[model samples]
Target: MSEVASEVIREMKREFKVVGKSVPRRDGIGHVTGKTVYVDDISFPGMLHLKMVRSPIHHGIIRNVDFSEAEKVPGFVRVLTHRDVPKNIYTILCLIGVGPDEEPVLAVDRVLYKGEPIAAIVAETEEAAMEAVSRVKLDLEELPAVFDVEEALKPDAPILKPWGTNYFIYEGHHCRRVRFGDVEKGFAQADYIIEEVYNTSPIEHAPTETTACVAKPEPDGRYTVYTNTQALFFTMDNTALILQVPFSKLHFVGGTVGGGFGGKVDVITEPIATLAAMKTGRPVKFKYTREEEMRVSSTRSAWRMYFKDGVMKDGRIIARKVISYADSGAYNRHTPYAVTKHAANIAGPYTIPNVYIDAYCVYTNRQPASAMRGFGVTPASFAVECQMDKIAETIGMDPWEIRFINAYRNGDMRPHQKVVEDATLIEVMKAAAELVGHKLPEHLLKMHSWDREKA
Candidate 1:
């Protein structure tokens, strides 16, 4: 539990049903016996299977999409392309005021990545749908693709997004920015400065159950969907917006998920399956194949971070600056918000007087990335903690001493001017250092979290 949660529990003092007590899993027996019904386990009498015709090239211009051969295949029902969708553009995070709807349900004029879905093929059987999708022809004009975040931000790099720039607009700014005190003055006053760079590649969620959804059109003119999505309201609202229908027209059934880890929150499968069901007036089932799940699904973003620190000889962090780039892949899935969150934590938990931060969410010609556990702040935390150790090594000071000296206190101010209160960094560090039997100087060991004067 977090420090604030523990504090809140102590204040409540009346809770005894579940707090701080061991509880049995409610669905353990059903899960162990394989009696729980998943989306794939449910079937309908007139259900049609859906398969996607994914792009084979990374970046391209669509000269033509020829489905003549696909139409001739036996049991072929129909196709859902960009033209069929009510609204071809949307952002998964738009409902939370994060976007201008930057993603397309189906590829319109061109595709941005190798696995971009260009069309959906529906048929009486899943095998027939797959065969039809494989037979669909694509006439594409390949364009040079940019893979690196730094290169994508360069002036000469090819523009991948329709925004005519590789980065998202954070209130008309080039990047999400943080400005506090003067970093130049901080550097001038410091006894020494430390600098380091860190990089991380994209990470896939790879849940045990791949993304799947089944949509059934009801007699009341509403669509009922069964999915494993972690967020139900997102599925309902996004699916309705993509279909250009009212919110009352969609119903979601979920909450029993195999595993999410922040990935299943994506509203990818429900919107298209709902459209297919409405088009055919029959139930539609769409389940991502293992290959599709791995290749086309959103993953954790690749991050490149640059850290600079100014410190005193007495183990005090005086100033800090961070410049981070979030590789958002072909679309701004959730990187814009992630970048903002990353920028907010540029100063970490230390009480630094001067700080400057510029965090960019850059686009690349790869599969669009999205949320995971700690979606935005994890990478920043990794860099911050690692740099603390490096700073100790350079200044010949114990890391615990350095942390104790600058840990946030009640009166300390964040880069955004929010006052820190009840910060436990000092207490946690001392306890952790003791756990490893790492000794520190007596003066530093005397520090406490509640000691605002020492902080």
Candidate 2:
């Protein structure tokens, strides 16, 4: 280990006793013993089951929510249509201090994505509630759906959320752009220029447990919910707003999460469960199957990035420019922040003197994306790292040597003009190379051997 890293480690060890030790988890015993009181395991007296009636169309205008036929179903207690929901439009992410761009509670007047909730059914029996949903027909007028980000960006594309010029919630130019030194001049001084485009697709966390929420209405016209949520406090606040009740009336208890790699952060099943309970005046439990969870819940946004790099004959990186476009499916859940972060991280750890990057979040008719593991860094890393390899090839230099010459160090200024603090990229690179016993290519090695003999 480096002296600095060792010192930091020593300091951390001094500050904390269990820092290096593998201490047993607090919930480990119950988890292994099967004694943990998970929400799905909890059953309440007179608790009713709930089921949602989701939109089958990708994009459509909700002409009507007819729940009259469902009221005749045996064991059916209460039904909640879009009209029954509050006017306040909010998302689970916004409620928890993520970002704005929430949709109307329940698909009000319009459904932007397939599997979006249009109405919910509540009943005495779980089977009855499931059957009751089929009776609650949603009359929807299909609108032109945008399945692709490129298509959505087209001038003639039907705007999903018409607030901005396009369907997306544009965070203005400041969020879309990044600049450093004069990129044009840097490229002009370069001996070689290379560019490549990288594509990434949406992926789900796919936790073993699907989304589930149980809500019980209190006598004081409030509801308490137990569900799988990463941000409990945020869910409570948003649920209260959606229910049109005081904050005190809504209580949230995050269950022992089976798993949520940023997927459970959104308020997917909670609002539906709360709505069902409130309407029925009885406790309601809603559990989503794997298929339903994947269909309706958000996932990581897909990214397409084009990287252009200018390199000197000696393999020194001079400039870099990246243009990234993110497919923010359906609602503007957290695309602005996602796109901004993607743009900021385009230059990676390379020490390019000039850099320019643009990231766009275009709306599409699919599940809205939220934060995922690694956030926007993975795509940016892949593009820049691959480009770095290409630059090495053109200059006939060792890839490691090229990286060592251009990799940013602590206190180095990045393309965004942000000074990096305590960066260990060089140390990490060398250590990794040494550990792997990296060797030069055959051609380079042969050339070097010939040069040595000549010398």
Candidate 3:
């Protein structure tokens, strides 16, 4: 072996403590014995249970809100509307320079999706909270609703977003766009062009533990919050910002989570519970039931991706254009960022010479989408990988052969003009072919990441 390769292996071995060895997991025993202190496992004294009064309409203008019946419910402590929230509006990604916090923690003048939180009730018991939440009356004027992004983008379609547009603005651009090289010329020079569209519906996180939080008022004036949030500091910052309180005033006592999978990334239940605790001077606990978790919680945005590719008979992708829409449901939770990521990665792990992409985070009359395992990139990969088979079928080439032919190599330019370095696509594909015993033509079998395909 070459000295450099040998040194790399040595370095890799040094970096790993459990490689090729039967090392026991550190936390497996504790989990198996039921000793983990998940957020749901905790309890406090005099804690008020909370529930939300959600919107029933997909899109509507709120004419009136009545809590008279809710107030009469036994053990009903308080009901908070959008008016009660100090800073009613916040985007979950605002800390990362994502601007114009469009989503209200509570529905303000309008409801854009079914099951959107319009009011929160805090009571002495869970039943009381549920009863109070159910009794809160809303007078909503129904509006024309669109579920599809294409439909939502039509000139005559009803706008679901508060910004008067159905889509998120990315640095003044209507969609997250990426362009590089001469795509028109590449398409003109291609032997065959393939256009394909792929779609994925809203995916739920469906963790063992649904969204939950507990907020406790402390004697020192700093509120203690326990939640299963994926990002603690982000949640803390968002909660503090939404409540219009200093960040230091909120103390986060969390790290244990049942399962998040990026669904817990949003600052959902914590802010409301904290506000309720501050108002009532008592600990507030809020937990979404299985139904609420499935209905109201953010899911992976449904994506509709269109790909137009310029390819040679030999399987090299010369040019590509990806137009995709992430159905952001009613609000911009993390979907705008997901759009940017989709724009960046839509073309997948390929080194195309010419590329153009437009990714939109669109509002629709559905449950808002936040984050999941891969967030935006998984669906992109799904579309591209599925297209690989389509491309092979179109040109009568091997599926794996096509991947190796178009896979990224060292110093190959990407869609954004970033030259790929140390790419492993060719090697990984080669290994997969070997493992699966996929037979490739002799010429195609010789391809390598370090060298161009001569087949």
- Using all chains and alpha carbons, the TM-scores for the candidates as numbered come to 0.95, 0.89, 0.95
Clashes of each: 0, 0, 0
Global fold similarity of model 3 (TM-score): 0.95
> Which 10 successive residues of model 3 have the least lDDT summed?
446-455
Better of 1 and 2 by TM-score: 1
Please, what is the whole-model Cα lDDT of each candidate in the order they appear? Answer: 0.89, 0.77, 0.89
lDDT of 1 at 260: 83
The TM-score ranking, best first, is 3, 1, 2
Candidate 3 C-alpha error for residue 426, in Å = 1.0
- Residue 135 CA displacement from its true place in model 3, Å: 1.5
Q: What's the CA error at residue 62 for candidate 2, in Å? A: 2.0
Taking the tens digit of each residue's C-alpha lDDT, what string does model 1 give over 214-320?
Answer: 99999999999999898999888989999999999988999888888877888899999999999999999999988898998999999999999999998888889
Off by over 4 Å in 1: 1-15, 434-445
Please provide, for model 2 over 1-455, each residue's C-alpha lDDT reduced to its tens digit, 9 standing for 90 to 100.
56998999988887886878788899999999999877788678999987788889999998887788888989998877667776447755554354454586677788888888777778898888878888887788999988877787788898776564443444445238888898889889989888888888898888888878899888877778998887787777777767777888887887589888888877667876887776777788988878887887788889888888888887778888888888778876666667777877888877788998778877788888777876677777877788878878878987877876676766678877788776666667656766899754443333211111222
**Best of the two (1, 2) by lDDT:** 1
Over 288-382, each residue of candidate 3 has an lDDT whose tens digit, in order, gives: 99998899899999999999999998788899988999999888898988888888888889888899998999888998999998889999999
Supply the TM-score for candidate 1: 0.95
